[model samples]
Target: MKLENMVRKVYPNLMPYVCQLADLPIEEMKQALGKEQVYKLSFNENPLGPSPKAVKAMQEALLQLNLYPSSTGDALLARIGDKEGVEAKNVILSNGADEMIILVAQTFLEPEDEVIIPEVSFVQYLASTHMMGAKPVFSPMKEDLGVDLDAIIERITPATKTVFLCNPNNPTGTVIPADELRAFLKRVPENVLVVIDEAYHEYADDPEYLSSVEFVKTYKNVFVIRTFSKIYSLAAARIGYGIGQEELIEAIHHVRPPFNVNSIAQAGALASLDDEQHVSESRRINQFGRKLLAELFDELGMKYLKSATNFVCVDTGRDSGYMFDQLAKHGVIVRNLAGYGMTTSLRVSIGQPEEMQAFAAAMREILEKEEK
Candidate 1:
């Protein structure tokens, strides 16, 4: 008997998420490039690093490694509730935003259900829906690469169980305007769940950008997901949470694993909330780096999205795979969008001034060589 036959039917058809340059080991890449320093802008990691308070808290938490974390994450949950202005009962903690997406699927999706997903949004939304053997209805993004609310609305049917929205969406970094989002939410059927992933919420400074957390307070179907991984620089820690109606949160708890979040991560995330200065500084620097990259792209005559997040997606006018390889050889790593079907675009994370300068120099060198 083939052991593979025993696996779930959906497992064989599902495509694994391709992480591009993020899959390459940084140390190995540095060694291969023969450089002591390599600028990694593939993953949208905080250039400032984790907050000092969070680091100190995690260090102190290390003393209790022998014990398990609070299964309920009571203290951390309370802190999150205070931060988000929601009751503790309305929040659900997960290992990461990815896991939160999975939990939502597990709790709500059935084999016959359909999940509406943006064609170019986060891969986890599609992955999670497939994991539950649910059909995913791909909604095409607008010409500007922004989520098309009306398109999603038009696609909804009786079988539609959930709609995934990524504000300041990954790769594209474009946000759903406040008024449009409000109208869309009102138009969506209350029976269908709407999952809004706001992993880059803290980075968005546009006045028109509205957080979906407020919607959660009034709409029973609205669920807002957030993470410490982005702004808090706790990507390795894998701390994320979801906010929704109390009943919806309770439903998710049924599928949540015991002690899912580790003590160190909880401590780091909890302390990170109090470090307002670090958050402010990170935001300021991100704005500066984003502007720098946008200016560089403009000078290069490249078409790029106007980003409200910590990354920019730019068309390279050449194969993204070639651009990725050339940049990697120059000790600079960026995300190639070939896997996402954007053959000529690359998503580059905003890094520190010196790191961005290195990337700028590498781009000039590569383009000059190509011209020659």
Candidate 2:
């Protein structure tokens, strides 16, 4: 039998995206532990839970589960446009921003085309580029773990088609400043698409952090991908979007599957968008939790990166595996960065105030017990 007919074959090119490293595996852990009282701080979800407005929206949307989602989602697109000062014609919603990244790659990349991303940023950019049979180039982070703009500029070449800069990057919680990003964008080849994945934009209160929404309007090569997951507490709902020149968005839409986002996500995201009180409360809680975690790290003499996002990258100064296990025994889960190649580090999503307090107590016990 021919190789194509002898047996079923996997898409060799698309396996990377298909085999996503489960960003958080605590759900499986929850199963193993028989549903004990656990504090789930592993996935960096908003401990505040979904917005009150969004909960109401989902409850209302339950009546329509029998019907297919409005794939066009023109109304949500319009709401996004009104908020971002863009035309609805320029926006495209997807299952989540990860899907938007995939859409861009599928629509634009060709075999051997080069995609560039930060050395220690979101892993999805690498997966998206690889899925298209493309080469992914990395711009190494500086000593402080922020994107090294100079390294990025050095890597630009004729084959490059896409460049993703994840502002306030994951696994490190570092961001490229406004002036640096502006200057870098000026030098980037206009022929290549530049994507700023601002999934954590809502948590970024730094005055110097620039939202690329305005840049997308000014530069045809620019695209801004944002998600409802982070601050809106809608990760389970999976609503995200991309904004860019109308022509680029139209092209991306060609590869998007019909009805990719379900009815519940659309309705919940729309309601969450208008819940300013919930958003404010979330920000306040995140700020408080972040500070408390920092203090605990200081008291323990453990070093950590000060974050502008909801999670913190703590240098555990020893193998992270033991502490990770110990914390699980304490029922307070966190992200193990060893998979991200930070063998001595762990990433903890700031949870509710009491969860934070309990986590601090657990940390003391683990460290003390380990030392003993």
Residue-level lDDT of model 1, residues 1-372, one tens digit each, is 786888898986678665445566678767777888899898899999999999999999999999999887889899999988999999888998999999999999999999999999998998899999999999999988999999999999999999999998997999999999999999999999999999999999888899999999989999999999999999999999999999999999999998899999999999999999999999999999989998899989999998999999999999999999999888899998887899999999999999899999999999999888
lDDT of 2 by residue, 1-372 (tens): 676676333245444323222243556656655556567777789988898889998999999899998887999999999999999999999998889988999999987799988878887888788778788898888988878988988999999999988887887887788999889889988999998899999999877788989798789999999999999999988989999999999998899999998989999999999999999999999999999999999999999997889999999887887778778788777877887677889899989999998899999998888778
Report residue 284 deviation for candidate 1 (angstroms): 1.4
lDDT for 116 (candidate 2)? 88
For candidate 1, the per-residue lDDT at 184 reads 99
C-alpha lDDT values of all predictions: 0.93, 0.86
lDDT of 1 at 337: 89
Candidate 1, 171: how far from true, in Å? 1.2
